[model samples]
Target: MTAPHTGGCRCGAVRFEASAEPHHISYCHCGDCRRASGAPVSAFVGFMADQIALDGKSLKTFENGPVTRSFCGVCGSPIAYVDERLADQIYFMLGAMDMPAYFRPTLHAHVREQLPFLHMPDDLPRHLKTSVPRPSSSNPDGTQS
Candidate 1:
């Protein structure tokens, strides 16, 4: 867990505040991630859903495989991901945070599809195509956007 958090999308329509810490912070570099963020990887921060307080308007979402992706309809900025089985937590976009600087990616998952030029530390485990991430690359790695 980190510090208290606050964030929203590109559009101001959807917003929220969390007076809790974050867990399972990492960057995912997979085909789905590339498509969602149009980058080598997608940086995400996970949080317990009950701690969040939404404001203004509701968000729209699409099913991207196992993740329920939420985003602001007005601005189209990706909001969060709700696990189908565990609705208590949400994976939110790191870029959507009001104070995003505090977070840094620990490792890059789904390394099988990482862009050739996208340089990241290789000391971390590189999963081939599929893996249920544990916190660290070793025994088990384990969260966020």
Candidate 2:
């Protein structure tokens, strides 16, 4: 299903679109995610990075040891959470996208930092940390079929 949604950086200079459907959707409460988004839990929809059209400029990435966080240089919006091992897939902040409320945590990562008031439901897999899978394609760029 094609959900024609669009969003941009805080400065509104950078924008993106998921012409097709999304890949992974989740709510992450990790420390890195909190710091990156300045929220208790950050929502994201995974996508083939190259699949999402970036109309303005590219992102400015910050390497925090094992992972890197990227954002629009013009808007400085929290754009994605990227693991070096899974460079093939990128998680675009769900809250950043202009779509209906689609908050479903497929898996909870970083239980240590999860809000104490919030208890995870057994329906979804819970993990201390998660490593999202790369798309099936083997292209150097993050474009999917």
Candidate 3:
């Protein structure tokens, strides 16, 4: 998907605009993500934090370990996820986007935690854990060096 993507919460209490193409896009089958989103799997569209602008008075955040997730307090719509390991990027929940069909996930993460009943017959690359690499000065692109 291209730039200027827009989206909001179910109640329209929170909204966001991303000014650039996503840096990463993937489907996560981790238990945490499943539980948080109340779905068997969750998809995210990642972008540099600076490339997105959020507007909401009902936005709330929850921090767990090195990750912080944000949602709309009014409707409990999951918004974004930020991991300290990838401090420069923010992953927005694909379901919260206005045109979710436009964003195609390139990979599957936490496959080991996927539900046995969920059968996604896709050829996308699968990872036992997260596919995102920790970013550092030597790995500015968040890729393994």
Clash pairs, model 3 backbone: none
lDDT of each: 0.73, 0.70, 0.91
Write candidate 3's Cα lDDT for 4-97 as tens digits.
9999899999999999999899999999999889999999999999998999999999999888999999999999999988878999999999
Give every collision pair in model 2.
11-75, 110-128
For model 3, the local distance difference test gives 0.91
For every candidate in turn, the CA RMSD to the true structure comes to: 5.1, 6.6, 3.4
Q: Model 2: per-residue lDDT, tens digit, 30-120?
A: 8878888888877778777667776756678898975787788876788776666676666778767766365354766666679888765
Query: How many clashing pairs in candidate 2?
Result: 2
Among these predicted structures, which one has the highest TM-score? 3
Against the true structure, candidate 2 reaches a TM-score of 0.73
Residue 91 shift from truth in candidate 3, angstroms: 0.2
What is the Cα-based TM-score of model 3? 0.91
Q: In model 1, what lDDT does residue 64 have?
A: 65
By TM-score rank, best first, the candidates go 3, 1, 2
